[model samples]
Target: MPLYQLNETFWFPPVTESLEDGLLAIGGDLQIPRLLNAYKNGIFPWYEGNTPLWWCPDPRFILFPDELKISKSMRSVFRKNIFDFSINNAFESVIQYCKITKRNGQDGTWITDSMQQAYIQLYREGWAHSAEAWQNEQLVGGLYGVKMGNVFFGESMFSLMSNTSKFAFISLVQQLKEEGIVLIDCQVYTEHLESLGARFISRNAFIELLSTNI
Candidate 1:
């Protein structure tokens, strides 16, 4: 299917219209309403340029709070208590570092200036949140995402030291589970995340899960 071009209209075409590679549409603005609407309907924007590109990939990657895995080594880290984790404590630092930090096999970053600004706006509105890791009062690693009802749509995460991002993520998951969050939208699969119990489900199943959670 040809990619849909979004304009001033706030509505999105159904996620089923996406192309084989999951490039659903292009030419949308990253306004807060559009972002929220997109996520609410299992869509999200991912761009490598000035124009926003929306996507809703098949076989959605996700994690159930109850299924989180703590490997032997990860369990060891938890027992060691080497890092301190906090929520919403250093969101700006976390996001800024994420914007500048390098990732394997990737050039530059997808967390553009506008994207950062947009998420910050969402944070201010209490729709976005961050989980931070600290060592000796210095921020070392963190992650940020949008929270919609009982589901958390993870965006980006960065680590400055080994296992710190995992520490922050584990902490966030445990907290969310305590508060009755049932699903975490991991978006896509990565080996690292898979080890922590994130797996893919069919698009139809994912949509049903989102609807039921909300």
Candidate 2:
């Protein structure tokens, strides 16, 4: 199935249309308008290179603000004020680090140059945001994502020091709670995120929640 097809004009069908057909389509432009529309419709881009690819998996991963877990050691770190946290305060640096940092089980990053530039533009337009962890006035770790209404779609995160990224996540959730945000979309499943209280739900359910909550 073509992931996307130009029907008369450029408007795309609901991403849910592709579930019956696996890995639906490929190749597209990542313009801001298209990205915003895709996100609003519960779709997201996740390609390996210059060619933009959109996806809507059958089972979506997400984390609710109230469900976040604070481990004993993590709590201790916060209690001792190990790092300072801020929001939208150094987004470019955070994304750059995420792009360059090596993953434990992965060889390369999916955050391509085009993706980086797109999100950076989104940040400047206030559609994207970042949470930073600073130690001794130096950025140790952080995460970035797009926030639409009350739904925060987490793109990626990286840690330079133990627990720094976690601290940034906790702070982001805290702020989201204050702002009346309802959902934090993790996009995919990972044990690390599960430990932080992220859970899975049918993609259908996720779309419904976004429809009602966002």
Candidate 3:
């Protein structure tokens, strides 16, 4: 199938037309309206190098707030209160950290300069949020994602210290649960996320969830 090329209008190709690898369209500007529309439809941008590629995977990875798992070891860490958690306090720093932090087997970063600037704009518009983990009065780890109503579409996370990202994630989940937000879209599969109670649902089901939640 031919990859769809986006025009100036805030629109996306049908998610069912995505490549087997989940790449659906390319060349769309990451404007606020486009980004929000993408997430609301279970589509998101992800690319390395220059081009902006959009995706909607067949088996969506997500974690319902009530399904978050905390291991005994992490429970112990939580008890220590060794980390401080903050929300939307350092959006720029969190994205910068995620941009630089190396991922296993991946060269360069998907979060390019334009992407960072766009998300910063999203934060300013109250559509993006960050969860920061601080230790010794310095930022250690955190995550950032776009929010549409109750649905949070997680983009990336980074940890300067072991288990710091996990701590921040757990904290975010608890707070979101309290706020009556249940669905968190992880977007893709990862062993790390699976261990934290993220599981796969059919793309059809995922789209249905987004329709109802956002």
Candidate 4:
């Protein structure tokens, strides 16, 4: 139950204490080995400012590829060819954009300088990837995350235009479907993601899936 410093790799008991809460060890460098191990163990880094906090939340939000909702409006948006999607095309740019973009109720950003550098490193090593949405050669929106085996751990996403991020996500999901991916780890709940068909699963269930899949 003790919260440790950011330099530690393992976490304490997850805040919720659920098996999925994954409050294991914490305070470690976000080096490739450490990050890979963390994801393999169902742990992920999520901290504000300079602290490199890691987490495993109970009742994690996830979206199975087949469960993705393609509402009529979204379908119409897709048909418009408003954006082009690519993978691992602009990983660092996507992360940097997500860090700088403003979110409702948030002035500063949780994606600190160190975190950006860390994820950039991950991308170089092929452990991380980005789904990019391009508008006439301009990067409008995208997302970045880690992929281990068949599971993708979503880190963050951003959009500069309406439905851009959604297009990137839908494209990523379709690609994952082609690659036989089964699960996407959303980490926490948000109505936006929920609206896209992401649903909650107990941390225990999440860990079990990670153990078996990743």
Candidate 5:
């Protein structure tokens, strides 16, 4: 499939046009309206160097709040109060940490400075949120994402301590569930998230859920 190139207008090609790797389009600015529209349509942006790449995969991975799993070890951590949890307590810090914290295979971060500022704007306007974990009055781990209607599009997470990011994720899910968020869009998959109950659903089903929820 041919990849689409976005222009100045705030629009995206039909998600069905995405390449096999789920890449849908490229070259769009991460403005608030454009970014929110992307998420509402089950699309998200990833960066390579300075280019913006948008994607929507065939089998979407997501977490249903009720399906969340907490292993015995993490449960013990919660009981021991190893980390303190808070919402929106440090949005910029969370994303900043995620940007700097190195992942195993990746040499650099997709969360560029522009992307960081864009989401920070989303957060200021109340569409984006963060969940943080702290220890000894210092930030240790956290995650950030955009939420609209009954769904949350999880962006990225970071941990300075063992399983701290997982703890933050679990903590955030519980809060979202209470507030009526039914779906948590992991967007892509990782074994860490799979263990926490993120599973794949068809693209058609994923779009259907987004339409229903948002």
Candidate 6:
């Protein structure tokens, strides 16, 4: 199948049209409405270099709030009060750090200046949110993502202090779950997230979850 190139129409092709590796389209601007629409349909934008690639993979990575795994050590960290947590309190700092935080085997961040600004706009509009960890009122770690209805589309996370990002995430997940959030879209897999009980589900099943949950 040929790849679709997005135009100013501000819509995405059906997720079934995605390529084998989940590349559905390219060239869409990251406007808030487009981003929200993409997320509502289980599609999301990730850039490779400068081109924005939208995807909805066959095996979507996700976490059920009730299935969250907080190991003895993670619990111990909480018991010890290792970090303080808040939501949406340090949105720009969290994302800015996620942009600059170096990861092994990665050169440069995918969160370009434009992408950051785009999400910031979403933040202002109340669709994007951040979960932050603080130490002595200094931002240590956190994550940012798009939240709609009962779904959260996680974008990126970073940690400056030990296990602080995980701390922030676990806290946020528990809070959202208490308030009726059922699904968390991890988007792709990572061992770090796997430890916290994120797993894969079929794209079709994921879409159904979105249909009912959102």
* Local distance difference test scores for all models: 0.91, 0.86, 0.92, 0.83, 0.95, 0.93
Better of 5 and 6 by lDDT: 5
> In candidate 5, what residue range of length 10 has the lowest lDDT sum?
1-10
**Please, what are the lDDT tens digits per residue for candidate 6 over residues 78-143?**
999978999999899989999999998898899998999999999999999999999999999999
lDDT of 4 by residue, 1-214 (tens): 6554444343334445433354544466777777787788777887655556677777689999999987788899888887888999889899999999999987888887888998999898888999999999999999999999999989899999998888899899899989988999998888878888999997779888888887
CA shift of 172, model 6, Å: 0.5
The runs of at least 3 residues in candidate 4 whose Cα sits more than 4 Å from the true structure, single-residue gaps closed, are: 4-26
User: Which of candidates 1 and 4 reaches a greater lDDT?
Assistant: 1
Could you tell me the TM-score of candidate 1? 0.98
**CA RMSD of all predictions:** 0.8, 1.9, 0.8, 2.6, 0.7, 0.7
Minimum summed lDDT over a 10-residue window in model 3 is located at 44-53
Ranking by lDDT: 5, 6, 3, 1, 2, 4
Q: Report how far residue 110 has shifted in candidate 1, in Å.
A: 0.6
**How much is the lDDT of residue 23 in candidate 3?**
89
Model 1 lDDT per residue over 21-138, tens place: 8889988688899988999999988877787888899989999999999899888988998999999997878889989999998988888899999999999899889999999999
Tens digit per residue, CA lDDT, model 2, 1-214: 5456433233667776775522434666678888888888778887755666667787889999999998999999999998999998899999999999999999999999989999999999999999999999999999999999889999999999998888999989989989999999998888878989999888888889889876
Give me the runs in candidate 5 sitting further than 4 Å from their true place. none
**Candidate 2: Cα lDDT at 149:** 86
Over 1-214, each residue of candidate 5 has an lDDT whose tens digit, in order, gives 7889899998998899998899999997999999988999999999999999999998999999999999999999999998999999999999899999999999999999999999999999999999999999789999999999999999999999998999999999999999999999999989999999999999999999999999
Give the candidate number with the greatest lDDT.
5
Provide the lDDT at 197 for model 4.
92
Sequence-dependent TM-score of model 3: 0.98
Candidate 3 lDDT over 1-214, as tens digits, reads 8899999999888899999988899997888899988998899998756889999999899999999999998999989998999999999999999999999988888999999999999999999999999998899999999888788889999999999999999999899889888799999998888888999999999999888888
lDDT of 2: 0.86
Q: Tell me how many residue pairs clash in candidate 2.
A: 2
Compared with the true structure, the alpha-carbon lDDT of candidate 6 equals 0.93
